[model samples]
Target: MKEKVVAINRVAKVVKGGRRFSFSAIVVVGDGNGTVGYGLGKANEVTDAIAKGIDDAKKNLVKVPLYKHTVPHVMEGKYSGGFVLVQPAAAGTGVIAGGAMRAVFESAGIKDVLAKSKGSSNPHNVVKATFDALLKMRDPMQIAQQRGITLSQVFNG
Candidate 1:
């Protein structure tokens, strides 16, 4: 598996003597075979922040349903003020997402998808929203089983 640093920000806190500076990093990890996760880390050093983020991401992993290099269906996810809409795309469409959404899709091994982010643009919120959407995805087989129907019945009947 490999990890990608999606975003990093330098944060500061005012103190008695001066401002204390720290780094916050968002990281995405993936095997390019369907497994993926994201994490946020804060530290005094950029390297440390990224390392922590990777560790956090590994602890929070989700499995996504992939179909022909895209998601199985269209869905919407919301977190706080962040809203995200994800749709499956043609094989060659590539990832049509920006900022945090793009990172999430790439890490999830989704080669083709269309995503739109609305409301708050905060990276944390956006990332969480994307994950929420992905988690809601249901595989066709799972859906069939839940409904007490066989796969063949679904497609042919």
Candidate 2:
């Protein structure tokens, strides 16, 4: 009762034999504690597809470190011929992203984010690239520690 599924889609492929149909699932799972995950799955059936996607997503879950209600920095990421740009915005900025990108941000518990997708209109690749960007995100604390400098000095520098 604590899990939520966002969407499911049917994808098709035509071969010599006939038309082959598969399902694609986009799932948003979160605890509302600044943790969320997005997954994509394809299968012969909707339920199986969703189950597969959810399982895979859980297994690949990455914690996105948040600053207040937004990301810690701006980052760009690419995957499977898709490109995504993610920007941190001031509070109340709201989510300004396309459908695919929106699902990724919303599931990640981000309240305010700005995103742009390019190179590919395929939702799967776009969302995956966005998640990759989120996974690469680093907070100030981590940066300061890695640089062996105090937080104040790091910020000032």
Per-residue lDDT tens digits for candidate 1, residues 1-157, read: 6798889999999999999999999998988767889989999999999999999999988788877789989999999999999999988999999789888888878999999999889988898999999989987798899989998886686
Score candidate 2 by TM-score against the native: 0.84
Local lDDT at 21 for model 2: 93
Give the TM-score of each candidate.
Answer: 0.94, 0.84
The top-ranked prediction according to TM-score is: 1
TM-score of 1: 0.94
Candidate 2: the clashing residue pairs are none
lDDT of each: 0.90, 0.81
Output the number of the lDDT-best candidate: 1
23 Cα displacement, candidate 2 (Å): 1.8
